[model samples]
Target chain A: MAAPPGPESIALLERFVAALKAQGVVTEEEIAEQIARTDRASPEIGARMVARAWTDPAYRELLLRDGSAAAEQMGVSMAGAPPLGVLEDTDTLHHLVVCTLCSCYPRMVLGYPPHWYKSAAYRARAVRDPRGVLAEWGTVLPDGMELRVVDSTADYRWMVLPQRPAGTEGWDETRLASLVTRDALVGVTLPMVAERAAA
Target chain B: MQDDAPPPATHDLGGAPRFRCTPVEPDDAAPPDAFGKRVDALRQLLARKGLMSVDELRRGVEAIPEAEYHALGYYERWLRSISGIMVEKGVVPAEALKP
Candidate 1:
């Protein structure tokens, strides 16, 4: 476990907040609102998009061509966030995303990044040995398949549009969305039909 | 082809060989704890005030000393970067950050 912030560090942060408030630079209400807004985001939003894409070819095209607009079409507000890019996983190729410099996630759709995504171990290994990293996550790709690692830099954030799993044909968007986990959207693992039985 | 590229910063670990052997922990999907949410809220508030941008925040994080950079946790680094940028941008005086 990481060490708790020392009392001195807490004091420093308290002082800084007090200073900002004195200057009218920020308000407590604004900070509370921001936290509430961030809390509203979750993987379920992304799953809704993925399930729609899987069932509707036209929506899938729109998602690939313009991610932000597609997200807006689903009533998600992308007013201040960076452009969202969707990486389509295919039969012969898979894509994994990492930000080697820092964690630049698609927070508007997928909520806050998972703890492991921000770790130095993940940031370094995801780019160098994506296949190995995926394997450690129990996501071994078939031999001869190509693995592409995309860097989610400061300008653009990325999420994977994992291919629709088999045995899910004719499933409605809601049911299909149930299978798309947060890990699948990040490309760390594929959406599995087996989860339905387990759940 | 030019071969004189400068060495990557300590934070730039895209394919550095040293991390190849490090083990990655399993995913923990829990939301950010209370302290982390507070730090994140602070950052969002700063950005809304136009006092800082995400790029500036990233720069501040990347500028941390290598040893300290590795030692700090995720949101700790974020809080450090946010405070540093606030001082650097004159949004907060350096003395205000002195504990």
Candidate 2:
């Protein structure tokens, strides 16, 4: 566990909260609700959306067209977040999303970003050498496949629509979602095909 | 306010070859602690109140020294930016933050 905040920090926090109350910036209930909203965010929401998109072309189109609305259809809330941009990956092209400045991300969908996603190495190298960065994450693309790096700036957040892996033809959405990891949605990895031999 | 280093553009990190390429593995998901929760709450409240824009917060966070930036955790950076902006706007006195 991380160390507790120092006495000075606690005092500062008290003063900060008091100032907010005094200035009518927010009510206690409102702050609680905001925190609760963040609490409700989870990566499963993204996994489910990706699974459904793989099953239904219409939903895939909708997801690509309006990510927030598509998320709302599945009972996910994108409140207080910038517009979501779902990058579609095709057989010939790949997409990787990064926020080169700081870790601006689609928190509403993917919950908190992984620690490495916020690392300076990722922020700098992702833009400098996307293919190499993805390779470091164990993702390699075939030759001649175009890799597009989309920087999610202050005004927008992005996620990758990873291409459905081959050989998962007759699987249910739940089973397919099991293969979608958070890294896949971030464009670092692709969904793996379930091994029948393990079963 | 000008120095030898390039002008302050936080989001202009694309194609900058100065940084080393060492991908750190992500840690397991941990629930927010008291400090992180408070910082997140304060950020939402400040934004809702129109006292601090996201752009302003980004500027403040990016203005942090690179070494400290790398040393601080994700939400820790938010707290640093919050503290800096609050003091700069005179919402909270700097003396109150003195350790």
Question: Per-residue lDDT for B1-99 in model 1, tens only?
Answer: 158988779899887788899878865764777677878899887887788899989888888899988877777888888988888888888888886
lDDT of 1 by residue, A1-199 (tens): 3345555556667887888888778888988888999999999999999999999999999999999999999889998899999999999988888888888999999999888888788899998788889888899887887888999988899989999999998899999999998888989899999867687
* Interface RMS for model 2: 3.5
Candidate 2, superposed: residue stretches over 4 Å from native: A1-15, A18-31, A195-199, B1-11, B27-33, B93-95
Docking class of 2: acceptable
For model 2 the local lDDT of residue A175 reads 83
The number of clashing residue pairs in model 2 is: 0
**How high is the CA lDDT of each candidate model?**
0.87, 0.79
Q: After superposition, how far is residue A175 of candidate 1 from its true place, in Å?
A: 0.8
Q: Per-residue lDDT of A1-199 in model 2, one digit per residue for the tens? A: 3345555556666776766667666678887887887778877889999999999999999999999999989987677679998999999998888888777788888987766776667788887788878877677899999989888878999999898889889989998888888888889887877543264
Query: For this target, which candidate reaches the highest lDDT against the unseen true structure?
Result: 1
Candidate 2 positional error at A74, Å: 1.6
